[model samples]
Target: MTLTKKILLGMFLGIIVGIFLNLVTPQAYPTIETYILSPVGKIFISLIKLLVVPIVIVSIILGTAGISDPKKLGRIGTKTIVFFLTTTAIALTLAIGLATLFQPGVGNFQLEGAQFEGKEAPPIVDTLLNIVPTNPFEAMTEGNMLQVIFFSILVGFAISQLQGRVKLVVDFLDQANDILMFLVGVIMKLAPYGAFALIAVAIGGQGIDAILAMAKYFGIVLLALFAHLVITYGSAVAMFGKTNPITFIKNFSPALAVAFSTSSSSATLPVSMDVAQKKLNIPKSISGFVQPLGATINMDGTAIMQGVATIFIAQVYAVDLSMGDLLTVVLTATLASIGTAGVPGVGLIMLSMVLTSIGLPVEAIGLILGVDRLLDMTRTAVNITGDATCALMIAKGEERHAESYSEAIAES
Candidate 1:
């Protein structure tokens, strides 16, 4: 079967196996998870991890080298960021609207002082500070994605400044990107095994009681996410790209699949870049800047989750939020999601921030922690969709910008 079919099959089998393990051989499930499943999942992750730095380096190098005009780079960066922020803001608003309308959090979910520990999210200025690494090697070693992006872009920019002498470097980098793409393709083939093992182990561990307890909340969060994907992403494509939403979805699926499986927008960057440029026909210059920045900020899915989840948790704890408080959540989550770096597990961290902002007990985080991974997969898919959507919109805008520039020149 093809990779996509295999992945779907694996997800199906994983759910079945997990349910069976939960019911029948519960004791043995841990052994299976520890020995067979976890290892496979880790192996899959390792392969992706191995590719991340090289992919970032080479892709940024290629993107920069392709930009003969440095002026275009600044313009591209500004436009990309503006588009990302706007979409992210809208995504948060949608999430909050749906959550409030659905009342997803209005039941008995005890708050019981849930612990929500996370790295202190730096201020926006400090976030900017973190982008430029003091040591590039240190950045890679720590797997600091934004820093890697910053350093790689600098490397690419510097390469661009060289007068024809750096053509060999650019050529070599092109070969490197090809090899990384091949490795990504190979790693994707192993997705079924990884997905199956990880899912089975996770579900088996979570148990049915937890699922039942959070069913309503789960449904609400999921529904909100679905709405954001269909409504927000679909509208963006229909209005901006002037393309059929279904066709856009079809083109976006491969990258979405990768993002779903990995649950890390940064990790999914290479594949996203490839699909955007190759399948969607977004220009290399556009995809390069937008995709990376999207990985950092355009977390529509996570924003949706934060919205529904916050309301769900509040309702469970019987905390009656004022309309003002709900709006506070909407605004904070929206801004926080936009500001959040699109790395794996950062959703939970951002969620924690949202909880703190609204005076919800952090301990409530433990309640959703079990299902967080599963939810994260879906959210990552949503995040990628938003990213891809923004890329297309910005590409369309850039085309318009160029047309305007050309017309102005002709008029002059």
Candidate 2:
């Protein structure tokens, strides 16, 4: 079977097993999860994580070195950040608009006994400042993505400047890039089993009741995510990248499946980069630079959740959100994407920040917490799609720029 087909099979079987465990043999869940699912899932995730830092560093350096122009790098960086932030803002707005129209929170909900305490997001200023690492090695150890990105770009820039002198270093990075990509291919062979175990654990742990109770809210979130993927990303890829939307989606399905299984853009980075480079024909420099940065800061999926959750929570609590408040949600969630980047359970934390911004009860987050995991999987797929879209668009733009420059020189 093709890899995508294998992944789909794993997901299908996982859903069946998960449902069976949840409904039929709830008692066996603990033992099954402990021995069978968790270990398999964690091992898969660990293997992927093991490669993330090194891959990001090596890929970024190679990508930037290829560009060899600070001005062009700056332009790509500007376009990438703009694309991420803009799409994220649009995602939040769509979620809020849909939630408001559907009124997912209008029905009866038991908010009295619900309790949830969110982790505090660090200040935006601090997040921005922290991008420049004090020690690049420490950043690599901790997997501080922004810091690592900053350091790698600098190394690439330096190599570009000293091209003749640093031929040995550049060649080494090029070879290292090849080796890491080979390892990525090796690791991906295990995705089916890993995806199965991960999905099984998620479904088995999250019982059906939570999903049923919040069906309306859940449905709205899914609809919004679908719309964003089809409308926003589909349009961008077709118009900017000059690629067929269906072709892009088809080639990118493997990464999407892994993203769905892991529910982490970071964990799925290796697979995503590979798909972009090999399948989509995105250059390493563009893929490496755009995707790693996107995984860290571009969170359209998380923003959608925050938007819908904020509106849903308000409705449940009978709190009326003014136009100004809705705008605040858009702005807060958009900026919070960057502020909360790389933090675990970031969706919930950012939702809390949005709620707190408008004086909503933070505890109301518990209302949707139960089904969040399922939605998280879907939204993660959406998140990485946005990342790939940006990478493809930027790659196409760079290609055109290089071609135009060559033609102009030829004429001169």
lDDT of 1 by residue, 1-412 (tens): 7666787788789889989999999989889888897898778767776887777777776776677578878877786777666766676677667767778666655666456666666565666667778999998888777888888888888888894898788878878778888888888888788778777876888878777777766777788788877887789889987778899888877777667766778777877887888889998766776777677777777877787778777777777788888778767776676455634467887887888888887778887876777788888888888878888887887788889999999999
lDDT of each: 0.77, 0.93
Colliding pairs, model 1: 105-312, 105-315, 109-316, 113-363, 114-362, 114-363, 114-364, 115-363
Listed in order, each prediction's TM-score against the native is: 0.91, 0.98
TM-score of 1: 0.91
Error of 2 at 44 (Å): 0.4
Off by over 4 Å in 2: 410-412
Measured on C-alpha atoms, candidate 1 has an lDDT of: 0.77
